[model samples]
Target: MYQYDAYDQQLVDERVAQFRDQTRRFLAGELPEDEFRALRLRNGLYVQRFAPMLRVAIPYGLIAAKQMRMLAHIARRYDKGYGHFTTRQNIQYNWPKLEEVPDILADLASVQMHAIQTSGNCIRNVTSDHLAGVARDELLDPRPYCELTRQWSTFHPEFNWLPRKFKIAFSASQSDRAAVRVHDIGVQIVRNETGELGYRIYVGGGLGRMPMIGPLIKPFLPELDLLSYLEAVLRVYNRLGRRDNIHRARIKILVKDIKPEKFAELVEAEWAQLREGELKLRHADIEAMRQRFDQFTYDPAAAQDRSYAKHLEQDSAFASFAKRNVLAHRVDGYAVLFVSLKSPSGVPGDISAEQMEVVADLAERYSFGEVRATHDQNLVLADVQHKDLYTVWKTLREHELATPNIGLLTDMICCPGLDFCSLANASSISVAQDINDRFDALDHLHDIGELKLKMSGCMNGCGHHTVGHIGILGVDKHGEEWYQVTLGGSAGNDASLGDRTGPSFSRADIAEAVERIIDVYLEARDSEEESFLACYRRIGMAPFKARLYAEEAVEAA
Candidate 1:
């Protein structure tokens, strides 16, 4: 919801102009395809297996209704009338022509959006909790910090051409909905005992060749010193992180080799030196940065002790929606509504142009004309009313947005594997559909309770399969589609990467394997309240492995 300042406006404007020139040269054959690929990728353009794909950053997954309208316009004017929301809280257009990208960037600039840092080896988009401003449990709204980092990292001279792409995420709330743990840098926003806002900084966490959880580089860094502390961490990483081998280039490899304690010591020494430098952000600047999140105007009339529960008591569909989709907002009257884009028999995060317009209209009409995209590949209305819950549900249902499957098995986070991605060996959308179709029984999924089934076609972990309660990764084995599974992974405060569960399954064997794993969970669980992750953790991998590998389970026992 942050509006772009003049400097922000000027920066994106200049970049867009520069990219236009680059694009013109590439089209004119002055630049070769390989040369253009690197240039364009740094600007968030990719040449997929078919056409070139352009990824547009939705910073921290926040979008205004006006921005949504802009996206719809982009879909209508440039793309194939739809946009695929990515797992990184970004949006991608798979069919973007190489020549049209600069024009697309121009349109995005008008809306205060861009693709900068959405790709490249430099610091990528700084993701945070999508429900930042609205989440009641948050220590502070994280967008200001994320925006600050965005400014500092964008075209940073030193780290601009790092060994590999670095991702950073901030989580301000009790829940780590942003999957901060799996990022290159994960900042857990916290308030000290003195009630001063600060960060618990984690460093060198990533997935790819080496999936390691970040270690706490700073247990508590004052909010004012966040930028300086971050600079220290990155400085250490840039100086020592490997460059000779692409596989060992990430900060994770450095963190692992240097040991977390030594890494922390180095960061501390660097911070001791530079903490007083020009980058030390002042309280006034923080407040100025904070003002942009003030776009939403609350309605006191829509406050609590309302009769909306009575309507839910009357209508079952509304009841289901109200129960599953709504979340607590910091404001008394406002509520956060998770509009499920992961509807039955649909793409996980693909919202059509009409759907986009409808949500945009709803946000403007009911909420505060503000929308958010979750890292979980869902849409959010950050300030819905308790009183207007049924009306919102009705509108969403009419637009086919009301799926009542938030946090359920069907609320899957998936990548556009094989369908759009050139690196993938198998189709993930079909795998997601198989699971959705099998558990189409909503009651059964609800009974299983809060199951996060994340899928990815490859080990890049875009879909965050490493952290899913039910993680499924697709691998190619001897030119055949094969699926690998992992369990007990979580991305919250107690974050840990899922361990691989051995032996890949055929495409035909995937659903059955999932069922077998679930069956083991059901049998081993202490109660229905115990989730798949909880059960798996409590009873180790032995039970689940037995069930998953059993001949009877493979043939449907």
Candidate 2:
């Protein structure tokens, strides 16, 4: 809902022009492959297994209806009629031609969007709670701060090329929907005892080779010093983070090696110099940034709808959809609807151009022309009136967007694994599809209840496998694709890395293994309310491990 001003427009236009020239040179053989690699990566273009993949950043996961339409247009014109939404709340085109990427970037620039910093050593997209302003239990809107951080880090001279890529996430709600704990920097908006707004800062949290839940570096940092404190933290990492080995280059590795206390000390020492610097966020600038976001206008008469209640009573399918897909909104008589991309047979996050246009139309008609992308790779219509919920559901169902499986096992977060990613050792999309097909029973999934299943093709943890209730990592074993499973991992406020199960399962047995793990959970759980993660935490890996290994032992015998 933040409109780009003339300055913002100018910056994006200039970058498009610059990248256009760079791309032309690279294609002309004037630029070396190594040099072009860095340039193209900075522009969010990756050469995949089959073709180039272009990742476009959706800052704070917010997109106007017009932007959505433009994205749909891009998909139709440039891509193969579809694009994939990613765990970072970005969109990706899997088969983009290198020569046409500049044209795509120009098209994106026209809509106040770009692929800049979506993939690079510089700070990536600044993500936040998808339900930022509209969540019923939100403490404060985190987007304003995310936007501020985006501006601060976009082309910051000191952090242009850090030792490794950086990510920052903000969550103001009690629920950690943004998975801030696994980010390079995690920001939690808080109010002090004196009722002044501030932040609880956590530094050096990340996944990949070393998964870590960032420690609380500063329990309370003043709101005015947000940027300065961030500068302090980044400065410490930028100077001290490892450059000798790419594997040990991330801030998390540095933090883990040096210890959180020492890292905190260093950050504090750096902050002491910048606490009063010009980088300090002033109230006036904050207010000006906040003004860019448009306030929603809710209808006073939309308190209740008898027809909606009737539909819920009569239609079991619609009832399930309404219950799972519709979330409570802060505004009275309104709801936030999750448009699930995880259809039973479809790819987890892939949306066709037609679906994009449908979502755009739905947003324009029902949600004030605004749409949001979630960290879980789903689209959200954040301002649907309760009265129109049934109509919205009908439209979504017609387009296969109403899956009614928001937090279920089928609603998984998966990466473009071996199918597209050249770096991948195994196929994440195939594994996800296999699991989805195996768990196609709606009643069974509902009975299993709120599960966060995540998968990655490799250890880069793009799908955030480290934090899923059920984490699956694809591995290469003797030229065969194998999967290693982990249990009890979570990305919430109480974040913890999952412990791996016994042995890797062959590609064929992976889905069955997942089913067995779920069966173990179902039988071991005290009640239906006990989720897979909670059950695993309560019983430990002994029971599940016994079940899986025993089955494997019997099969081997």
Candidate 3:
């Protein structure tokens, strides 16, 4: 995690003071409700269905134990005793008083965290693989790039107010867990044949009412030109992106209207204006920023221990947890453990204050006091040692954090849809609960394999339904909740948007619909090794669509 430098510190401090003044004026009736609402939202404050919601930025999804404890304290002292971790790798508090939000901002600033750039028509949080520094397949640590971009984008004079909210994601890993394809700017970093690390930039990628996979504008962008290239991309989008209609204000709409080729050419032209000496990406700056992310350190000599194997074999429950929760680490003897908030019969990405405190404690005790939030809505203790796996699993299970379902169908990516979000047309949390309860068998979920069942409340695609292997989007038909399905979408190395299957189904019929799709996938698969995505890709949607729309699939049969 990048410790806040003096400039960063001063910037947040100033914003906190500014927000305090705004809070005073709003409470004093000096500012109108509408104006205050807009201003508050820009500061990550929202008036929710039942209360105010405040979103706090977790830069690149990295957090120190101290910061996590601060969040827990806030949840305990001010709002409800829990917070919702979002799919964008941020945390949201569902209940914060309007007048007290500034104090909350000040509290966040006390720990070097803030809620700035969290909402409203600006470049939002820059997210990357939560496993950025620890993942085995990573080419380069993208936290430095993400931090550099965050500094450049935060409060930029030109790009501050855009047609709509913009998002960017970066990945240095060979396998894309960050879902980079669905962001406005998806950056994939790679080393050249000669071993020079650079980025393969993807532009105009986004999911919402209109979803599209980003196009490769620069097949290989030298790291030195990373900032300049991004500047050029933003310049083009800000200049030409639609602003006349709120519904069609995203860069994806502009990209689709202009076609990807022309958009690429426009970015290229903009890049030609500001390349080389014209920009400011010196090696010293990169090194200075990179040093900030160099705080994490761990041991690498626990894998060969006889005690580790003995511990695993002794406890069957611990063994099950080790198999499901622990992940491969670049450092031998170390493992990355994913703590799933999406437990059976629970909210998808929520943690109570006690739960937060426990995770903070576990991070300090067993995982070096570092915790990360995944884009898939899970918490990660990135550097646990193999010898500590049993102890860690036991503690997590005691706290209800050990769910033994990392990448299963039950580990769903969901948004706070109509049940909570004012923008949603249908409920998401309820639907997710339905699916989880319906597919409670761990073996069946694990056996079905690699199924991403993403859901969004509506067409805004907050839940990223456009890219799920089996996407489900909630819709409202004559005041009733229904779901629209999409098939064959993926977000890894090869990205593709899902295609619509057929008509929407009632909320009561959705779990069955999903099961029918899974049933078809299970029957059509060549073997158990052929996962849902492979089967969907190999067979396409025709067969799945036939099964989904068939009357047999709609009924219990």
Candidate 4:
């Protein structure tokens, strides 16, 4: 985790004080509601259904144990006793009082955290792979680049107000765990044929009402030009992006209308002017940022431990948790442990204050005091010793954080829909709960195998429903909540928007509809080795749709 330098600290402190004054003015009626709304949104405060929601950024999804403790303190003192982790690697406090939000910002600032750039149609949080440096197949750690970009974009004078909210993601892993392909700007760190590092830039990728994968704008851009090239891209978007219509104001829409090739050409022309300018990345700066990430210390002796293998054979429950939650680390003796916030006992991403403290303690004890938040609303203890796996699992189990359902049907990506969001047409939390209860049998979930089920209350796609293997979108039909299902969507390297399965199902039948679709996959799958996405890709959605609509007809008759 990169500790804040003096510059970073000063910026956050100033922003907090500025917002505190703005909040005071608004509360005193010196500022109108409309004027205050924009100011509040710029600071990550939103007026939701019942109360204000505050989104705090976890840059590159990296947080130290101390920062986690601070978040727990904020949740306990300010809002309700919990916070919802989001798909963008941020956390939201849904019930914070409007007047006290400035104090909450102050609390976050003490821990080197802030809400700036987390909201308000500017460059949002810069997310990266949770595993970053620890992943076995990572080409390079993307955190330094992410950090540099975050600093460059924070309150950038030229891009302070873009046409719409923009998102950026970086992924260096062989597997695209960061969902890079679906972001506004997805950068893949790659090596050229000459063995020089560079980036493969994808522009115009986004998922909402109009879902599309960003096309490759630059096949390979030199590493030295990372910042300059990014500036060019933003410059082009800011100049030409639409402001007439809110729905079509995103960079994706601009790219779609003008075509990606033209967009790239415009960016390239802009880069020609700014390539070696002040924003050009320097080697010393890169190295300094990289040095901050080199904190992991592994014990070579743990590599020789045979106890982990023995324990796996001896304990089925522990083995299940290990198989599902434990991930391969680059070091021989180390492991990356994913803590599931999607336990069936609670909402998909809500972590209680107590759980936050427990996670912080576990990270300090077993993972070198570091934790990473995932894009799927999970948490990662990225550096655990292999020999200590059983003990870590036991601790997580006691805290209800070890759910042994990673990549399975029960581990769903959902949004706080109509229950909390004013933009929602239906309730996503209830749908997720129903699906979890219906698939509570661990054996059944394991059999389902690698299903990415996501749901959203409305078309805003906060739940990322467009990218799920079985995407469920809630729609309002004459004041009735009906769920629409999509299949064959994936957020990985082969990112594709899901296709609609059939007509929408009633709220009562949504879970059963999901079960029927799963049953169809089970029957049609070539083998257990075939995942839900793989099988759907092989057979298409016709079989699932036929089965689902057939059930609908039977009920109608």
Candidate 5:
């Protein structure tokens, strides 16, 4: 994790003081609502349906154990007893009072965290692979670059108010776990034939009313030119992107209207001027940033524990947890353990204050005092020792954090829908609950295998439904709640948007429709090993659509 220097600390402290005064003025009627709106948004505060929501940035999804404890404290003291972890790897407080937000920001600042640039039409949090430094197939660690980008973009005067919100993600592994293809800018760290590291930059990728997989703009951007190239892309979009219509304001829209080739040409022309400018990364600076991250000390005897093998053989429950929640780490004796927030008892990403504290304790005790928030709304203890698996599993199970449903049907990515978001059309949390009840059987979910079900309350695509194997979008039709389903979408290296399954389903029928879709997949699959996504891709949408609408077709007849 990158520790803040005096300048960073001073900047945040000054911002906190500035926002506190601004907030006081707004309440005192000295600041106009319109003016305050921009100021509050820049600080990551949003007025929701019932209360104010505060989104705190967890840069590149990395948080120290102490920061996690601060988050728990904030949840307990300022907002509701729980907070929601978002798809962007940030945390959201749904019930924070308007007057107390400055206090929250101050509390966050104490831990070197803040809500700056988390919202508004600016470059939001710079995200990366949750498995960044620890993935076996990684070509380079993307966190240093992510941190560099974050430092460069925070409060950049040129991009402070873009046409629309901008997002950037980085991935270094062979597998694109960061979902880089769906970001406004996606940087894939790659090594060329000469073994020199650089980036494969993709531009114009986004999901909303118009979903797109970003096209490759620069197949090989030099290591030193990252910031310069990004500036060029932003400059092009900031100049030509639509300002008249919010719907058409995103860079994706501009890229679409102009064609990707033209967009690339414009970016290239801009880069030709700025490539060797002040934004160019120096080798010394890069090395210094890399050295800031603390390395973990792994136990040499971790892999030699016979008790771990015995526990796996003796306890079926522990074995199942180890099988589902544990992922292979780059280190020989370490594993990445997922703390599932998707327990059937509550909302997908919502974690209670006590639960947060538990995770912090576990992270400190087992994973080198570090925690990672995943884009899929899960917490990861990225460096747990192999020998401590059973103890960690037991502790997590006791706290309802060991769901053993990672990448399963029940382990879904969902947004705070009508329940919290004023822009939502229907209730995402309730829909998720309904689906969880329907597919409560772990054995059944395991049989279905590796399904990514993402649900969004509206077309904002906050839940990333377009990229799920099964995408559910909530819609309002004549004041009634309905859901539109899509199939075969993926956020992987081979990213693609899903195809809609004909008509929308009533709230009552949505879960059943999902069940019917799953039934069709199970019956049609060549073998148990074939995933739902694989089967859907092989047979196409015809079969799933037919199954989903078969009853409606009969009723119509």
Candidate 6:
């Protein structure tokens, strides 16, 4: 994790003081609602349907154990007893009072965390691979670059107030776990023939009403020109991106209208001027940023422990947990463990204060005092030793965090829907619960195999439904709740938007429709090893579409 220096501390403290005064003025009637709206949004506060929601940034999804404790404390003291982890790897409080926001910000600042740039039509949080430094296939550790980008863009006057919200993601692994293709700007760290490290930059990728897989703009960008190139892309979009209609304001719209080739040309022209300017990164600068992060000390003989194997052989429950929740690490002795928040009994991504506290304690005891939040709405202990696997699993199970459903159907990505979001057309949490109840059997979920089910309350695509193997979008049909389903979408290296089924289903039929879709998949698959995504890709949408709509067609006849 990157520790804050004096200057960083001063900047946050000063912003907290300023916001505190601003909040006070708004309540006192000195500040207008319209004016306060912008100020509060910059601080990541949103007035939801029922109450105020506060989104706190977990930069590149990394949080220290102490920071996790602070989050647990905030959840307990300020709002409801639980908080929701989002698809962007941030956390949200649904019931924070308006008057107490400044106090929350202050509490966050004490732990070197804040809600800055979490909302508004500005550059939002910069995200990267959750398995960045620890993944076995990673070509480079992207956290240093991510941190550098975060520092540069925090309050950059030129790019802060864009036409719409801007997102950037980085991935260094062979597998694109960061979903870089769906971001406004996606950077893939790669190596060329000469073994020189650089970036493969993609632009115009986004989801919403118009979903797109960002096209490759610059095939190979030099290591030293990272920031300069990014500035060029932003400059192009900031100048020509639409400002008339909110629907057409995103950079993706501009890229689409002008064509990707022309967008690339403009970026190149802009880069020709700024490539060697102040934004050009030097070797020393990169090294300094890398040095700021704390390095872990691995136990050399951790892999030699026999108790982990013994436990796996003796306990079926522990074995199942180890099989599903544990991941291979780049280091020989260490392992990455996922603490699932997707139990059938609760909302996806929602964790209680006590659960957060327990996770923090576990991180400190077993995983080098640090925890990571994943884009899939799960928490990670990235450096857990193999020797400590059983004890960690037992503790997590006791706290209701050890659900062995990492990439299963029940482990879905969902948004706060009509329950919390004012922009939602229908409820998503309840639908997720319905589907979970329908597919409660662990054997059934395991049989389905690696199905990424994502649901969003509306077209904002906050839940990333556009990229799920099975995507569910809540729709309002004549004041009634309905759902539209899509199939074969993915957020991996071979990214693609899903194709929609013929018609929307009533809330009552949505879960059954999902079940029918899975039934079709299981019957059509060549073997059990074939994943839902792979079978869907091979068989296409015709079979699933036919199965989903056949009953409706028959009833009409």
Which lDDT tens digits does candidate 1 get at residues 1-557? 78888989999999999999998998899989888777898889987889988999988898888899999998888989889887788988888887889999999999999999788789998889988888888877889999999889998999888888899999888888777777889998898899888888888888765788888877899988988888888898888888899889999998889899998999999999999999999999999888866565577777754678789789987888877899888988677899998988689999888999999999998877888888888899888788877788888998889999999889988999988899887889999999888889878878888888889988777788888888888888778778888898888877888877878788887887887787788778998788888888889999888777767535321
lDDT of each: 0.86, 0.91, 0.87, 0.91, 0.93, 0.93
Collision count for each candidate, in order: 0, 0, 1, 1, 0, 0
> lDDT at 117 for candidate 3?
90
Any runs in candidate 4 off by more than 4 Å, and if so which? 553-557
RMSD, one per candidate, in order: 1.8, 1.2, 1.8, 1.2, 1.2, 1.2
Taking all chains together, the TM-score of candidate 3 against the true structure is 0.97
> Which of candidates 1 and 4 is the stronger one according to lDDT?
4
> Can you tell me which runs of candidate 6 are displaced by over 4 Å?
552-557
Q: lDDT of candidate 1?
A: 0.86
lDDT of 2 by residue, 1-557 (tens): 88899999999999999999998898899999999999899999998989999999999999999999999999999989999999899999998888999999999999899999988789999999999999988997989999999999998999999999999999999998998888999999999899999999988788887899998889999899999999999999999988999999999999999999999999999999999889987899999999999987789877765777888999999999988899888987888999999998789999999999999999999999999999899999999988888999999999999999999999999998999999998999888888988899999999999999999999998999998999999999889998888998989988999999867888888898889889999999999888888889999999988888786432311
- Residue 480 CA error for candidate 1 (Å)? 0.7
Pairs in clash, predicted candidate 5 = none
Model 5 scores a C-alpha lDDT of: 0.93
List the candidates' TM-scores in order.
Answer: 0.97, 0.98, 0.97, 0.98, 0.99, 0.99
What is the per-residue lDDT of model 4 for residues 331-381, given as tens digits with 9 covering 90 to 100?
A: 997888999998998899999999999999989999889899998889999
103-218 per-residue lDDT for model 5 (tens digits): 99999999999999999999999999999899999987899999999999999999998999999999999999999989999999998989888999999999989999999989
